[model samples]
Target: MAAFSRTASLLCKNAVRSESLGKLNNFCTSARGSKSYQLVVVGSGAGGAAIAARFSSKLGKGKVAIIEPSDAHYNQAMWTLVGGGIVKLEDTYRPMASIIPSTCDWIKDRATTFKPDTCTVSTQGGEEIKYEYLVVAVGLQLRYEDIKGLTEGLEMDPMLVSNYSAKYVTRTINAIDKFKGGQAVFTLPNTPIKCPGAPQKIMYLAESKWKKNGVKKSSTITYNTAMGVMLGAPKYAEVLRGVCEKRGIQVNFKTNLVEVNPEKKEAVFMKLETGETYVQPYDFMHVTPPMSTPTELKSSPLVNAGGFLTVDKYTLQHSQYPNVFGIGDCTDVPTPKTAAAVASQCGIVAENLAAVMKGGTLTRKYDGYTACPLVTSYNTCIMAEFAFEGVPMETFPIDQGKERQSMYWVKLHILPRVYNLMTKGWWSGPAPVRKIFHLGLSKQE
Candidate 1:
């Protein structure tokens, strides 16, 4: 840690400007700077951290500052596996200090407000940070309080579990382990979740686990979702339906979980169509909480009517404020939010942002490439890769709509390496691999 600090200090003195690397009590800095940075990024999650790493490596030290509230970041995608007892929660967390590039100014504070018109961002601690360019990637916030009795039910009831947080993640496995019999329910929220496939993934794994534990005959597994269809993409939707039918996994569409009765062990659900309501007694329930844009981005002048940062969908530039841009889950990009999407978008954003900083026209546009590894069981997964319009934009030559063990292996074994390398700005999307796999069958523009 001391070596890391010394290296950062040396880099700051020689390469970075002092004003851009603002003093924070938590951060260690010994260097001085006079010039301001070219860009400032908010948040340090998958999107913010990856983009910051890319730009800092490209632009060199003293040119970028990343303002983030939390010092720790956990991968939300792997939480399902953790709940299934396939992966540990500790395997998901990475220290923000180690992941972020040393060349970048890491502000250990949250952005309380954004004044994009003035090209300034204010921290929660009342520090004002001005920038020549800005990127918003704060991601979504989980609204656990919106659902009445949901939070209390999760905390008090041992049968209630959620993969959304590490605190409740262990409860999932415990719920499964203690299941002697009865309804094992899993729900998908009414709002847009980070990984759209996560809710169902846990259900599939739970069903498989029940069979292995010899409780399949007694337990009735139900997947209740708010959406009209099983999945957003029609191709994958059909496959999922077939799998559910073959496995006897009952799905109730348009059935949204609104409340919970922990004392009675009953879960209340609302029907979207006829304004009807129903209740089902459950032995276990896994809830995926509703999500919304971060408060700072929502209230900012840079945001749109929808409360998301308004950006040109293709170019990722702020619609109301030209100096501001957004990426990842926080922006209204009309694309699914996933780590794969962040990896692909970071490259394009970095390129366009660098061009803008040099007084040049932005040249790159995001194609809305996003990927979700739908882990079915211990060794099986379906990699659903697509674009913004819900079209099948696969990175492999094979039929991606079908579930495969190879794809599962990639998600479980390979993607972490790809993510680490890519976030460090050493790699991009798997376009090269796709081309090689398809050979002459590659699509032509």
Candidate 2:
């Protein structure tokens, strides 16, 4: 209780500082020459945007800068719905300027190199930005080129689409609409992906769409995944397996997509255990490409042997560099990489980094809390919330593993609004709500 009170008091004092700092109108917008700040945040995705907002307010104007090359910010989570035809692609985009806090200097450039030893970052535009503290929030890079012929296939074959990419997401529904009752295949890659549930989510929605269009009896639906289990969480995995069995969806585990023959309309897969290759012909296919940390990060000294950011899974601070922190998919946190995970990590990064700035002990710790609303149909979803090691940390009192229309409603309508609030530093996930629902008995770590 004493620890909690002290941490709360520290955060309160920081909030007061944020209010005062926000009033300073001095902002930098240049991409050339050398610059410096108290803090420099790389990448402008979920983790980058939220953390930048928090510190840009807390540290004052001209004290913080964000280096990113993209002009538009996207809520990538919505791409699944967009692919399902539940929402338009335009609905998920906000101009990057609008999302970035006014107090922070937006250095519109890509980070090409990181020199943690000197607290320096080199941008592609020949600018050197130095900082007292650094936050690496650069998200994973989707490697569509990794699979043989996959890039050409996506370009030449109208039936080949992936919900993972914004360029190909809209093509998903179109391909589904064009299908005239043939083999429909969906694949999960061998590498870690942003949303582990997304590769299968589109399958469920497509199956539902086929049923609605009277093609369910004629079309065959198959889910080919690289993972041995349906989901990481055993509780949710069991339920998902039952759902697939009931829906007659064939599950092929440990099978990875290795290549796409666009001319032949076939996908080649390799078995992980036996190293055996097989081919599946398809009329329509959804592919989740392999992903990795950005090239700049992978080659840097900040990453681990696996090329992911080397941060303490609990503290989110770089193992070697005390002033360096990481968030989102780039970090080697042993949790499913999702926006929900990023939201939970944002406050931890903010508080711990603030404590570092104050020469105080880091009190906050992240428990790997993440949520995945598995949309099973047009109106039903299973809300899976868990902590480290797949321990269920549900927010509602009711059974969240069960498919419910209310959960789908929340996913469809409420999550996006909450996401926007998170980018603006106004939301910090549903921890408080979970505590209230569980009567203060919810797992804290």
Estimate, for each residue in 119-140, the C-alpha lDDT of model 1 and write its tens digit: 4578887777767678898999
TM-score of each: 0.90, 0.92
Q: Candidate 1, 181: how far from true, in Å?
A: 1.7
**What tens digits encode model 2's per-residue C-alpha lDDT throughout 163-271?**
9887889999898888889899999999999989999889999999999999889988999999999888899999999999999999999999999999999999999
- Which is the leading candidate under TM-score? 2
Residue ranges of candidate 1 with Cα displaced over 4 Å: 1-36
The C-alpha stretches of model 2 lying farther than 4 A from their native spots are: 1-33
Taking all chains together, the TM-score of candidate 1 against the true structure is 0.90
Alpha-carbon error at 159 in model 2, in Å? 0.9
Candidate 2: lDDT over CA atoms?
0.89
